[model samples]
Target: MGLHPIHTSKSYHDKDELGPEGNEFTSREEVFDYDFYKKLASDPKVLAIGECGLDYYRLEPETAAKQKESFIAQIELALELGKPLMLHIRNAYGEALEILRARPGARGDVHFFAGTWDEAREFLDLGFTLSFTGVITFARDYDEIIRNTPLDMILSETDCPYVAPAPFRGKRNEPSYVSEVVKKIAEIKNLDFEICRTALLQNALSFANIH
Candidate 1:
């Protein structure tokens, strides 16, 4: 069986009416739940402490500061708890890299990573893995990076209800489509599909330190 219940905490940005039964983080303190996340992540089943990181896409000065604060707080929590992070970075890899550099031994999977080779290498150097998403199925930008990234340092994700793979584009994504992502990775790396699939599963297990 594949990994399940991969719990994560707040991201830098969130949608309106975002959670079940209308429950949501209603304030800056609640949204950037550093203390709460540390407690949540301390659970043995909560393998990582994220879906959290910097997002400079809109680039608001005030919002960016809050994002940084939340990001760094989560980094500290993950480092202290000895848990891997599940990062969500966009247009902020350089800044994220600098922050990570300051925190040695901080390691995690860069979810839906679409960074340049130099950026990817910087994270890789810091022992982070680049997780590819359904974007690779429709875009060619990620091809070279996948080819260059070490198999053991690579991961697959659906990023579901968002970037659904080709042939499923415009449809809400589900975890079942992750196989398409692994197949694309296998194609890019010129490895057999099953071999690539097994390797990715093992990579996730090891990265999260799950037995």
Candidate 2:
């Protein structure tokens, strides 16, 4: 797997159920230890500071508030660490965008982005990139968005062991399936396959701040 660099992220989730499972569980307090994050973020191998953001898909109002607090704190950490944010937003783009917009200079990818072009534009305007998963292969819903997005602003991901692409739709997804995602982007944008592949590779490397 030397094909791509591995960039680990540290994030804070308010709910206990959402934290790490089993004996290795991370408590809410530990999630917000600025000094702990500073040490991890200081590591050159740990490229970014997230997969963290608002997820209002499920939660009570109080829990959602805590998620927001955690999200904002992680954003601060990314800014401090001078690394890009690896965001995971769902059913809460409006709230997420508000918090992201408040930060001004903050930048990162909206990983597995499944939002509208307008929402995507807002992220692009913030100087952030958008990464897509294997969903685009079977679903035509995202075609226009894929076509509309600037090539430099797009990257490929495989939110796997799930969202496996077509022809392997029901199986557990592996990183290799990301090539299918890349292929779909090329088809949607009507670009030559190699050009799309290289652009996406460079886009991911550049936006993720990997060497």
Q: Report the Cα lDDT for candidate 2.
A: 0.76
Q: Write the per-residue lDDT of candidate 1 for residues 41-157, one digit (tens) a residue.
A: 788888887787876665655666667777888888888888888888878899999999999989899988978999999999999999998889889998999999999999999
In Å, residue 107's CA in model 1 sits off its true spot by: 0.7
Worst 10 residues of 2 by lDDT: 1-10
Cα RMSD of all models vs. native, in order, equals 5.5, 6.2
Question: At residue 95, what lDDT does model 1 achieve?
Answer: 92
Which residue pairs come into collision in candidate 1?
A: none
Angstrom error at residue 197, model 2? 0.3
lDDT of 2 by residue, 63-148 (tens): 56667777888888888888888888877888889899899889888888988989988888999898898889998888888888
